[model samples]
Target: MNQDLFDNVRRLVTTAAAGLAARRGEGLAEVLERLAQQDIGPGAFREPEPRSLPVLRHLPQCVGEAMVLDPRLASAIASVEDALQWQQSASYTDDLLGAGFSENYGWAEIIGPRGFFPGDDVLLGLLMLGPERHYRDHYHPAPELYWPLTAGSFWSRDGGPFVEQPQGAIIWHPSMALHATITRATPLLALWCWTRDTATPAQLA
Candidate 1:
């Protein structure tokens, strides 16, 4: 692992978390505080095992738009995009989501069990959904927060109707809350985190 790259990612997560804490309520503030206290030493990170997914084709555009919303984060992410290990949820199959959707939806873990930096009980990563795709409701033991960095994306929770959120919008889902996402004309790119209870994987609702 490149020491400089690891440091840059740490800086990005720290800056983004602080910015999010300032704009969010007490719940998110608490999560950010806990995340700040994690030990992200040189040994915490390993060389990423990169994987190419269809959704990654749209990453350049998403990163370009994200630069306008959060320049530092966008730059930092872009700098290390090729080094991140992109992966799809194990539970999602072609039978679950259509073949088209399965290929075009994936996440890149930045700080988690399989991420560049192994988190003890916290997970931070990026989620990408391609244009005009529906990511059905799914639930997990870990409470989650999503910070969308691009436009034209819609989100829903607890089986509710999806609502469009603008750039820098934050969405929170308590543990085991059913949540889903949709992308319109543009692809979706968001920073996501799971605070605690990171053992269980997400299950489709």
Candidate 2:
């Protein structure tokens, strides 16, 4: 692992986690720690040939609104190159799965020095969960934030009924809030954050 890179990501995760804690505490602390340790940046991130997936939805509401509230947040996203990379082989059932991610899920570590809005160590970014035929219920150990850049996706949490989140829907899940999603008609795309406890990834119960 690159110590320099780790330091950068750690700083970012810590800042972002702190920010997320203001709105949501405890749940995100771990995610922040985990992200701080990764090296998923330009070095490991690959640039692939141009290709397009069949289904994808655009994010609405938040991007512009966030920019209006905090112009710097919008600008921060530009620094992380891998944030937009088409990950790869998200789903495998002949076609894509609803929550399975059509391509490999991508995370751009938008929290550290090179990222947007310096001074903030919060871990946040744009994410794309390619289409899956079906998305099973899974929950994370950290507080999570979701601002779907795409539309027409359903979100549900532990025993809770599913809710259709259109673009710009601010969805929050406290730690261990069994959540599951499904995409229909088209592919689903959204922004996601591990907030804190960066080491923890969601698991299907």
Query: Pick by lDDT: which candidate is best?
Result: 1
Error of 1 at 156 (Å): 0.9
Q: Tell me the tens digit of each residue's lDDT in model 1 across 103-168.
A: 689998888877878887898899999998888899999999999999989999999999998888
Give the Cα lDDT of each candidate. 0.86, 0.50
Q: For this target, which candidate reaches the highest TM-score against the unseen true structure? A: 1
Count: clashes, candidate 1: 0
Candidate 2: stretches off by over 4 Å: 1-105, 112-122, 131-133
Error of 1 at 78 (Å): 0.3
